[model samples]
Target: MNKLPPDPAPATRLDRSQRSGPTIRDVARAAGVSIGTVSKALNNAGTLKQETRERVAEAARALGFRPNDLAQALHRGQSFTVGLISNDSFGRFTMPILEGLESVLHDERIAVFMCNATDDPEREREHLEQLMGKRVDGLVFTARRADRRPSVGVNLGDLPTVFVFSQSDDPRSFCLLPDDEGGAYLGARHLVATGGRRIAHVTGPERFEAVRLRRDGYRRALAEAGLDWRDDFFLPGEWSEQWGRQAVDILFSSTAAAPDSILAGNDQIARGILDALRDRGLNVPGQVGVVGFDNWGVMVEAARPRLTSIDMNLSTLGQEAGRRILRMIGGEHFSGVERLPCTLMVRESCGAQAKTLFQEARST
Candidate 1:
């Protein structure tokens, strides 16, 4: 009789032949509320009494109900996803822009899909089509350099698109670019402030728009400082370390007075100049102050004296683009190219006095 202990009641079981587990209906039934109420409670939508929301939430937990994302998206009429297309296969510039976009998008609970076209029109077309097929809510286009590029040839009808670090030929498109002219002006002014009167600008080919804009900015700063402008002071060549070294050699060989300060086009060129200066037993900052563009951390930090350079504020550019795209997606209109400002990163290469000034200004 003790062993018998009464026959145990049969356990309740779900029908295995049908869909398994609890649905929204199950949660509603358990909570003694309507299905719509359960949905609003679970999604934190609509106005509901606290008691009812708590009851529905508890019931959902007890029944283990999970809402289907696709179904929810269909109900809301928005996928909450975006696509990022870039021709920068190496990801040097693209990564930072993506980071900035993600940082802003994360708070909004949006998702991003990324594709690299590798500077190939065919690949770009394929990726664009794939993204369109997936029904991305919006698109962001970017490139390795901040330049004007031809269209990607995708018919983006009514899709909210923003271009970053590049420009589209379309006049009505929203494009965000760094202010290269402002950045160059900052670098040149810093050198002049530190008592560098005879300044030289060694930069990449003149064919690049960035080079031309930066050179213009450099001249503007020198003119503002009342320094004499010399045509021989500007050296345009390839954007490489070898070019930097050769430019230095050529400058010294010429009868023109040796430049007191050298403004390099990019960090690579700056590094090369630093090396050449060291080999010639010239003291950086003391003998010849140096500044560079791009403020690329890898080359700047690795230089003997950390290189002072101009930062394009690419992350901020991406953030601005993100905000603009979000507004456009929300039916707000925006057009024309927006130019973001740049800042000079003062380091040892610019001389101690300049670094001190930069630090003081930053602190204030």
Candidate 2:
């Protein structure tokens, strides 16, 4: 074997300074703070005065010094990153939450790692272990609905965690859920305010916790307006536009008087109801008012009179979750369930002109 041409002279290398960035020590000097303080400020751990942390951050930004020593940071049990695990494969709900969460964490220089568990137990367990191995700073769990589900099987051992669109069984666990009952109430009450009596609720399966809550809310709104809820007026079917179209015929045939207003469980059903009503030569908001949940823009915009719907405020929920989780990571404890209020997207479907209606004054 021709002796490897005397191990070809080693290729020339660039000096650390030539390809390097400002060091931690440089940041410390620029901020007039100790290296420990700089690490605390950048790594987001340990005790440091707020003003001093801000100074260190500003100096690091000015010098373009970013701490990239992962091993050293994890050895101290700190990582300036979070892990978000979601079961929503469609991203129909999770995307908005992620957008809000990133907006909050990005400002603090904390990064997030997203994982899709897709309603699989084994996959979720595996993701939990992997996130732990990465030494994430905290965890956020989001589901597609506000139903009670199994707790995280893995023992996170004091790791910060927040749940969204679902409630944990444990009272000590921090949970967030959209106020579905309140949302339905707002929809029905708006119908009443806009002169809709004989209101009928066409909704999804009753097995769903949200469905039952909305049913109760619909009844409550009518009751408050001195209108009794007729058992025949309530229709429960699968969550689909087809069922919505079918229900219209069923209601008209069974009841002596047709419902003047219909509150659909979701935008899909609302669109179907609108289509069927139009076919029957009924003028929306004149012959019948309509409302839907979820405020899904695609279906709402397509429906005649622009389907008035309840907004779950998923983005706001995500932002709030991010803020609270960060606080938990910083030694604050937030336990118990927090039900964020839903918003009403006022539109022509409810006999109201499409207009901006802020939530706080909803009753008006």
Candidate 3:
């Protein structure tokens, strides 16, 4: 009697065909409606009875069904995706720009596809083609250097495009760049104000547009302050720490009056100058002041006395580019280059507050 009644097979067991997760058809079946009706109800597209819409929604919730974004985008004729092409493989400049762009576009539910071209024209062309094939709504082009660059071989057609830290060969294309000249002036003026009369400029190669622009700014600042420009005061070389060190050596060797202040091209070069100064036992901001560009946190903070540098506001440039691209996509057009202003980040290197510290120390 105990073993007499074996349990019957469970009636709730799904068949092989029904083992998969729910689909629109399953939702429709569960809601006692057609697939088309279920789609319209779920998407809230076509008009439907209130009761039917509620029923479809409930069925979808019970089934844990989510609409396919790809399909929805295709139906709407917009991918809602943007491509970011960068030649800055190291991400020294591009990363901040990308962060700003992403921050702005994320609020609008837009996605970004980033591609590093590594300064290779062919690879850039390939990425552009692939993004085009993916039906990206727009593109943002950026580079490590903010110079006018040649076409990447893609026509770009009607796709909205924005250039950041770079420019297109076509004059009609829109671009965003930092005010390098302004940044240089700020650094030079700061040094001069802090009692650095005999100022020197140590920078990258003369071929770079940045070098020329910054030099011009430095000269303008000196002229405005009534400081005479000397041929031996400018040292143009590589964008390296070693170059900075060497430039300092050559500067002191070639001149009877040494520079009381040095304006470096970037943080790295500034660090190099600091090293040379330390080796010579010259006190930073006491005997000489230093100013660097880019305000790269890593290099600036690592220096013994810290660095005072120009902040290019790269993220701001990126945000502006993002806004402009969205506008372009929205049928509003803009052309020509736009330059964002740079801000001075005061720190120990330039000695803006050193005089007060010295006076306080003496009093104490």
Candidate 4:
């Protein structure tokens, strides 16, 4: 009945703190402009005057307004996204390669969506299709096996795709690979210079393109030295420590000449070789010299005898892959197969001549 004394004139007051977060509308209001004007100014549309753009930007900064990437991408008809495919396992080798790729891709304001294929053809195909469905602007592949075919569940028509640390003969695909031949040549030459002979090799699958290149490098070095590459000196095996360790046993048990030098497929394999050498009471670089690939820091640093190894520079491979894919997206013509240079890090295992070879390689 009292009517609350006419509602006390409705308490004529505005709640400045009522809004949750800053919005474009709030920015427009603060800048004393219309919503369309604010949008045009923020987007740097030429239709807006410079003074209006400045005022709108100032208002946005004051209100802490930010543009949404997804919305902006939608408006621009671009996803600003890249899809990365790799092996299924979290192998130590792939991490550095991924980091390198990520660093370069992030600089270009591109988002990367990655998946592991687990070396399964079907799973890889499925993930590829999903990424394509999401409209990624580009695609990257890091396969466990060097020989891998690419796919996107579609023709991939004009989509940009690149492979890193792997290879594909598909004429349509771009591949960035380490100079395996060059790296192997450097390692073998280092061993030969360090007064190491009776050189032998413990290697991964020869079917892989990179592996074959490395083998060719080994042969080339031997040929350059006017030495015969004996089939017995080349050991085909898995890229594992067990293979290296067992190789030592095989070499020691047989009357066959023990290699004064050995080239391993990777750091892990090198570690195996070292373990077997130590077990047999042999000193690295003294009784036997060893060289490996994939200059893995953890093993090389903690190596008891300090293993000498060639670095494929997987990170550089990744960065180049990213750059090439970007260029491809920009409609630039590129070599379908790009080879990245690698380096050798000399240490106690293969003896100290590695530094000299590295220097000479750089000069050449």
Candidate 5:
């Protein structure tokens, strides 16, 4: 009897895969529809009645059905994936950009392959090659600085490439950047409207293109307000808190009429200016109004008097870049540089009653 029971146990040839879990067929059966209709409803492809789509979705949920992404990619002949390569080591910029970009991508069930080049040319080249080999639908390159950098070193014709917060000399490239020049103009104008005369510009090195552009903006604002753009009033130094403090010391120690206000290069420097002013018994917004660029929340919020600064709208930029790349993937042609305008995040440090002043300035 035991020998007969053992003989009866010979296994069926059907593999375990066919025996386990819910598949599209299971959903179709549960929803009382064809497998093709289930697929169409789930993938949002081809028109279908709203009730039918809802029924299929309910069936999938109840059965715990998950369509295999690999199978779908194969059927569609597209990986539904993209590559994002960046050299921003200090995640201050890249993290938010990814957050914004991925929000758009997740809706379409697309995936991202992120690569950090670490500011090495060889490493960047290898990443580019690897992404291309993976047959990605599109590529995005980003960096901390707004300066021009070398292209990916390979001619990728019509591959839906996008560059953000950085640029290339290639005339045909689609580039996205912040309008730093206009931002600086806005900051300086705010100081003027706040009643700052003999204003000093304390900023980063002149070698940076951003610094130069901001300088032009400062000059233009001063010119418009009929204030003198004096050479000594322009203080160029490293973009650091220490430099901000040092510039303040140098300005106060001088025999020339001390600046009634200062426009710092970045948030860090602005915080330092505030700290130095505290040490020297100077009042902000009353004795000296202060404004900064790069309304970085970490520094601005933590500062003694929260900083009033320029907002680069980086998240908006990232979202727009994602939308543009999606359109590019759909065969849209875009070329040349696109500069997005920056906004002023008015706060306590600007020496005016924050609410009414911000409203008034925005109205103009």
Candidate 6:
């Protein structure tokens, strides 16, 4: 067989024309003022007289010259661009969110410079420095952990930052997390309403805020139904299909017996569970009901049983993050945190009798 060549490298969105627009010196010449006076006026320095500031401003406007963001950063030590950093897996989850944010930021004409950290602190540090050099206005990071405090390169105090799809213990930075409590509550409610009791939970690593929140949501649901929460009924593992398989072992080994329904932390985990169950001659929704978080349409549709899951609304998540950053840039203030909603998607995995079977189950 003949071998195929590798794909071409992706083109960079950044270009010289985008970065190297009109210059401050050009503005100063057009304004007919000393470069220092123009700089002072643009920086809003009190050293310049009020009339002088007006003249400089008028000159800049006439010449169609805007302040060079790079030059302005060198003087005032702040960039207008915001630094966005995330890992590959997080990048996948954040794509829709970015789309949402872009919809808003594109209107504001503010640029978002992104970096892939690959979960490496060293790489993160390197990217952080690069963004600082670019004089980014603020930052938005999606990873749960940072190798070093952002202050190592950029001034976090003067610059605004917001975290999305992750949590930070820092009180100063704003955070937005998925509504795990709500998702869990809804998952349990769905199962119960559909005649599911003896529920099982396949969860992600406890270290992740999203994972923990989903687990709590499941627990709350179980409690609301007046059912005892069983630790043995829980399958704890990584966020992968393999972990879902591992969860199955833990589920069957439990003394209380395997559950009729399951709340998987995410779709990938749920997929593993579905496949493993089939290997054991189990019919999903008939022998076992399954629900997953992060409703990846392609994956869910392609699955044999077509897994039922929750939509974390990542696009909405991104949109909100974009809005927050724009608000900060535009001098609007937002406080505390915002939590987005999750939607429950029904499919065969939940074992809800087919809508056609609904009448049959009810008649029975």
What TM-score would every model get versus the actual structure? Answer: 0.83, 0.81, 0.88, 0.84, 0.81, 0.73
Model 4 residue runs over 4 Å out of place are: 1-22, 77-80, 120-135, 353-364
* Predicted candidate 5 versus true structure: per-residue lDDT over 317-359, tens digit per residue: 7887888888988879898988888888888888877645432
* Model 2 spans with C-alpha error above 4 angstroms: 1-69, 360-364
Question: Which of 1 and 4 is ahead in TM-score?
Answer: 4
Q: Sorted by lDDT, highest first, which candidate order results?
A: 3, 2, 1, 5, 4, 6
Global fold similarity of model 1 (TM-score): 0.83
State the local distance difference test value for candidate 3. Answer: 0.87
Write one digit per residue (lDDT tens) for candidate 6, span 169-284. Answer: 66566777667768777877788777788888888777766666667777877887888898877767888999998888778765766788888887888999998889888898
Question: What number of clashing residue pairs does each candidate have, in the order they appear?
Answer: 0, 0, 0, 1, 0, 5
Give the whole-model CA lDDT for all candidates, comma-separated: 0.85, 0.87, 0.87, 0.79, 0.85, 0.74
Candidate of highest lDDT: 3
Location of the lowest summed lDDT over 10 successive residues in candidate 6: 355-364
User: Model 6, residue 182: displacement in angstroms?
Assistant: 1.6
lDDT tens digits, residue span 1-364, model 2: 5665567778888899987878999999999988888888887789888999899999998998867757655656677788999999988888888898889989988888999999999999999999898888889899877788888789988899999887777677898888888899999998898899899999999989999988988888998999988998899998889988998888777639899999999888888898888878889989899999998878888888898999998888889988997899889998988788888898899898787664521222
At residue 43, candidate 6 shows an lDDT of: 89
Best candidate per TM-score, number? 3
List ranges where model 3 is wrong by over 4 Å: 1-22, 42-44, 49-64, 354-364
| Backbone clashes in model 2, listed as residue pairs | none
- Ten-residue segment with the worst summed lDDT in candidate 1? 355-364
Ranking by TM-score: 3, 4, 1, 2, 5, 6
Question: For candidate 4, lDDT tens digit of each residue in 282-344?
Answer: 988888999988888988878878878888778887787778878878887564776777788
56 Cα displacement, candidate 6 (Å): 18
Candidate 4, residue 39: Cα displacement in angstroms equals 2.5
